[model samples]
Target: MTVVTKPKAQPRAFISLRSSVDFVVTSTTSEIIDRALGYLRAGFPVHFRGPAGTGKTTLALHIAAQLDRPVMLMVGDEQLTSSDLVGEQNGYRYRRVVDRYIHSVVKYEEDAVQNWVDNRLTTACREGFTLVYDEFTRSRPEANNVLLAALEERVLVLPTSNGANAYVKVHPDFRAIFTSNPQEYAGVHDAPDALSDRLVTMDLDYYDRPTEISITASNSGLDLAEVERVVDIVREFRDSGEYDQAPTLRACIMIARVSALQGIRPSLGDKRFVQICLDVLESKTAYTSKNRDRRTAQRKMLVQMIDHHMAHPLDAERV
Candidate 1:
């Protein structure tokens, strides 16, 4: 007998979209959207702070598109440097010439020169693009110090050695959107007070249950019933206080998408589907009891919850 094995799929390369983010605006988020647009239009930088998977970055991109300007997205990280935000002098080019003036005489001349490369922030400031600096707090505050002048004084100081080209006036149309998670979250830095004072800061929490259902159903291409079941289970886990990381709508979307792709019904009796949910969500929940093994306790709790929910599903209105 011959056996066949399926090949693993390769990861896709990063591609920036020219079009605006396709977002479904339910009644819950409509007001927030309008308010955010109002702040951006009134010439103030807008900042969105929220937990992971709350769609802060998505909303920022959508708002940027509303401005009818080109979009530039920059993700922050620990290694992000000031030179990365502004322009940097990269390497050098050399020109050399040799001339033979006479039979025994020769002259040689060489010149080396460096050229500046504009990074996302500088280019956005110069060309009036809507800059979305997502998760800006992940980067050290010093790396973002350049923004103080740009946001307030409408100017960006260049790192040029020559005094003549020290700064550029920020284009009148240039706008910025910043996003970050709460400080208690991992890999976050306390934003400088001066910089925070300049932005129109807004807080975002997870969408209401109904909105989450809508978002999960729309994004995952799953039936509403199945998506609801998945969402309910994840929400229960989140509220249980058993996990360090609450399973967000992002986790719901992942489970829904995989199940839809494989035609697996969301059921506790189905070992395969149960395993999928546990694998995607089990590690996120933390154990608070000192005597219990975290991994084992979490696994038992999730299994029991899945079984209970499957047998007696929550009422439609409750979730």
Candidate 2:
């Protein structure tokens, strides 16, 4: 994470979608996108399930944007509740009236009522905004129970709400995209069977080699050839299954982007580049001071692995 002459301002590591020209589209991603879009068009809520760093959230956002609708983004949390997704009555609204027509008698009336405010889910269902619920499994399953009817019956049931607002008919244009990391279990809950049945789930994994190279190059502003080196080393390290946490394409972008900013090449001959690789990838291990020996051993292996990959060029093939 260290750089020689640190960037004074935030680095533009990524060139975001400015137009169709800047959009990162490849045959691999296009197929996935078209498939997800098709399910969505068929009136099914699409779920992107995967392990961490698989681009689930990014792909969800891209698909949502393609729908040409205003998007509502909500991140699931351990403390999230149904009221957090839908609306809830918090404060009270009060009104008072005094009778002036009766000269002989005075009358006064007062009433207090609870106020209901729409939350992200309620608003999206009511206004037809596309909802991208990221990492939804992190929220308690009970909290997400509200989505069952919203996704299935095309209505949001407000059991606690009273009056004509008891239920909201979901807008025709309303759509939902959910992303979750199944490998995360500490705070994440299992997807409810009912909820899972309602969604068109798409399990995802790392993209092919060319897609990774294109994404890294596009995001880091590094040329494809240099980006390929960083990707190859990291991908090989991941496949080795030696690290506690596997390095994803994100790791590749970090090395390439930072090296480019510092005018360093992604070559083992450059000490700075090698350090950057270790700094980016080695810490992904589970080693701590309790096992400094293991940490050092992994560090040496990472360096040797980098040298090996840099020395032997991998053929341009799907990995």
Candidate 3:
């Protein structure tokens, strides 16, 4: 008799092509991969905190993809309810009815099933999918109270229409990942200590120079020289402390793309390109009359950066 053997499953690629399409812009870094692996191995909920435009959402999505799990995403808001995280019961519907006439009063009872629980957390737990809660702390801390037990004990105590006695248990394979800006940013809430203790927070910083330039070049369709120039300019501004808020690689890519679209070339004489950098810095920093001198110094530094870029084209290649 001949026996058939099952084929072994091949390992998934580190970076899937489908996952790449999810984020049009991303700053690739080894730290991101390390954090993803840490979460996967530790079996703990992971939280990503960073400044705005630092690709926290993109990183979360990429990590979810790397885990090779179905992703259920929730964008937190102030109006979010427990039902939004757990589940709610809609009105009951009667599918079958039988009537028998008798001398006594007819007996009737309603039958119901608590089967429809729809929410990111509930569905992820029930289906053993990866849950991405973006800007989770933006909502009231009370809204996430339903998640405490689910995240800690791997069991979701859901509310059902039957009564307080009804609840749904979470599946064992579920995992959660969260991403949010720093609490100092507007519209962010301080994460409750209870929830914070349950998660491993990975504070993400801006991408290092080479990675930033590569990401900007790949996404912006700009030459490496142009990408490096933009990176250098931003890095100088950040290191010099001329601008209170440093422009992110994302901002640099935007400026490059806009410059290219406007027929601006990579040259020091490009006033429009310089203006783009100024606009990014001005919009990101809180302007005040007291910092007028600082602003002027920043503009001078920006001009010097442009001149340096034009004078030494080979310097842009190093990044």
Candidate 4:
């Protein structure tokens, strides 16, 4: 029952989606974006659920930015607690005074008080800031209980016993968006049913090839053809059903960015380029079949894919 206080975080860390400015809105992703925005505008909390690298967190931030309110971001993890969310008495402040002047003067005074610090949730709720709770499922359900009332009743009950108001009225402008991967993923807990019921959950998968190509090209500053080649190579492995978790757009960006920066072409003949792709991608391939050696099979597949793409460079215009 002890309150644990962590240092105050910069307000911008929770709400600012600075990277969202460059987020691509292509034909494939537009519908998802529009739907999420619609739900948020309707005063409903939107939850973007998907696999890692699907850009769930990014999309959540984009939606939060669309609200045009001060932003607050809260990361969820196993050790998170209600105190962590709603704020706690950070510590105490003390002061002592001594008086000595007159011939017989002798006086002393002392004062001590708990220092109350508002957490991200409390500050955002009170100020009506848009909150993006990323990877919320990583936090235990009990830790997130504080959000039930905030989401349902628009009130936040403070957990301190320092004799202050027990609850806060949520600001009318307050809105929240949450992002998480599937429950099957490791280290993620099931969301409380009651809390889940209050949200409009949207499932996000990998972006279509063109959308991904655009994202990679824009973010990595690589030639469109090079980006497309990498994207195609990744897509082949992903769709081949060889891995439980496919490399995502993030992998494409990494490969593209490194290649562009290092002046390494995305080709099988280039040892560094091949190594970069394998390092960034090979571990994600599940390689679960008992029939073959996973490590060897995975390496071979990657090498062949790279060689194929290199020999037959994608037609940038057609792509």
Best by TM-score: 2
Steric clashes per prediction = 3, 0, 0, 4
Q: Deviation in angstroms for 242 in model 4?
A: 2.0
Q: How close is candidate 4 to the true structure, as a TM-score?
A: 0.85
List runs of model 1 lying over 4 Å from the truth. 1-22, 92-113, 286-292, 312-319
For candidate 1, report its TM-score. 0.83
Estimate the TM-score of every prediction.
0.83, 0.88, 0.80, 0.85
Q: Give lDDT tens digits, candidate 4, residues 1-319.
A: 1232344544434445565444688877778888988988888999999999999988887777778898988899999998888888866766666666555877777677777778889989999999889999999998988899999999999987754567899999999999999999999999999999999999898998899999999888888888888898888888877776778899899999999999977755679988988887887865556735876887899888888888874464336
Cα shift from native, residue 100, model 4 (Å): 11
User: Per-residue alpha-carbon lDDT of model 1 for 181-210, expressed as tens digits?
Assistant: 999998999999999999999999988889
Cα deviation in Å at residue 302, candidate 3?
A: 2.8
Show where candidate 4 strays beyond 4 Å: 1-15, 20-22, 93-111, 162-164, 268-271, 286-292, 314-319
Q: What's the lDDT for all of these models? A: 0.84, 0.84, 0.73, 0.84
* RMSD in Å for all candidates: 10.4, 10.8, 9.1, 5.5
Off by over 4 Å in 2: 1-23, 102-107, 312-319
Error of 4 at 117 (Å): 1.6
Q: After superposition, how far is residue 101 of candidate 2 from its true place, in Å?
A: 4.0
Q: Please, what are the lDDT tens digits per residue for candidate 2 over residues 1-319?
A: 1112322332212112223433588899899999999999998999999878888988888998888888888999999999989979867766666665667876677777776778889989998888999999999999999999899888899856477888999999999999998856467789999999999999999999999999888888876778888998899889988878779988988998898899987765789999999999987887667978888888888989889867854343313
